[model samples]
Target: MIPSRSDWTKALEIRHGKSLNEKFSKSTVAICGLGGLGSNIAISLARAGIGKLILIDFDIVDITNLHRQQYKANQVGEQKTTALSNNLREIAPYISLEIKNTKIDEDNLEELLLGADIVCEAVDVAETKAMIANEVLTHMPDKYLVAASGMAGIGSPNEIITRKITKKLYISGDGVSDVKNSIGLVSPRVMICAAHQALTVLRIIAEEFDL
Candidate 1:
């Protein structure tokens, strides 16, 4: 069963503090890409008590995604955001969720980012990821960006470094790896990157880590 607000408050108090939990429960985050990184990050944020989430993804799940993504194999062929939304609701029923089963582009980028306290770029495509970064940094300079890159293939876990791009932008994962090389991805590395992204989101929300 989903935990109640008071239960969440108590848990946070035990884990962090009441002040941190309050900040987390009041923040809104938008996650672009419902694949491996985005899926794990979104679930982590929801379980941590983020009050609202806006999830966007254009593709449907495939058997290949089951290796790293949090969705079940039965969800194959279903829209990415839709399946993730169902999963999150099961985890945090009291939280508000918005799912956009469409591609994030110049046209709808603003709408997708509207009212989002922080935007996480977990998409796979380089072009779309760069576009979102430029759009967000240009229009909403104060908003935070937690992005993942070079998460493909098995590499040194120490290679994944979380760095600040700007006062409002942060990136995690190795800088050299690429999906084009067919480096491939396994669950461990993807989840590591996702954890970094989620922790960055939490830090941003709590004002503990400034850009």
Candidate 2:
């Protein structure tokens, strides 16, 4: 049986302290792109008791995604938004989720991420990443954005670092590695960047800023 909400939050309170856990439990985070980086970031945030997650991804899970993404073999043909939401519910049953199984572009970006306190960019294409970052930073001035840049290849995990770009924008990853120029993405390196993004969101909620 699923645990009661109080019992569920009690555990997070112990690990995160009551005040921090309350903040986490009240935050809404939007994750764009449910690929390796996005999938990993969603899992981390959900596990941390983030109140709601807005998951946006237009792609379906493929066999190629099994290597690094958080989907199973049976979910190969399933839509990423649905699959990831299913998985997250199993981990954090009480966590609210808003899923959009459609591509996120300048046109519908704002509406999709309307209530998010923070947005995470995990798209694969460089152009798409730039567009989302620009849109969020330019249009959604009030929301915090955590974007990744260079978690590709088998680079040193330490190279995956988070940088504060502005008051509301933070970037994670090596800022150098690219799949087209490198040996493609490795699971560990991708996850490192995602963790940085997830932690950055938490820190933002906790009123911690990087100087």
Most lDDT-accurate candidate: 2
> What is the C-alpha local distance difference test score of each model?
0.88, 0.92
Predicted candidate 2 versus true structure: per-residue lDDT over 1-211, tens digit per residue: 9999989999999999999999999999999999999999999999998999999999999999999999999999999999999999999999999989898888999998999999999998878888898899999999999998888888678887899988998999899988889889888888889889999999999999973
* TM-score of each prediction: 0.94, 0.98
Look at candidate 1 and tell me the lDDT of residue 128: 91
How much does candidate 1 score in TM-score?
0.94
Write model 1 residue lDDT over 7-63, tens digit each, in one string: 767877787677887888889999999889999999999989898999999899999
Q: Which residue pairs in candidate 1 collide?
A: 153-184
Clashing pairs in 2: none
Backbone-clash count (model 2): 0
Judged by lDDT against the true structure, how good is candidate 1?
A: 0.88
What does candidate 2 score on TM? 0.98
Which runs in model 2 stand beyond 4 Å of their true positions? none
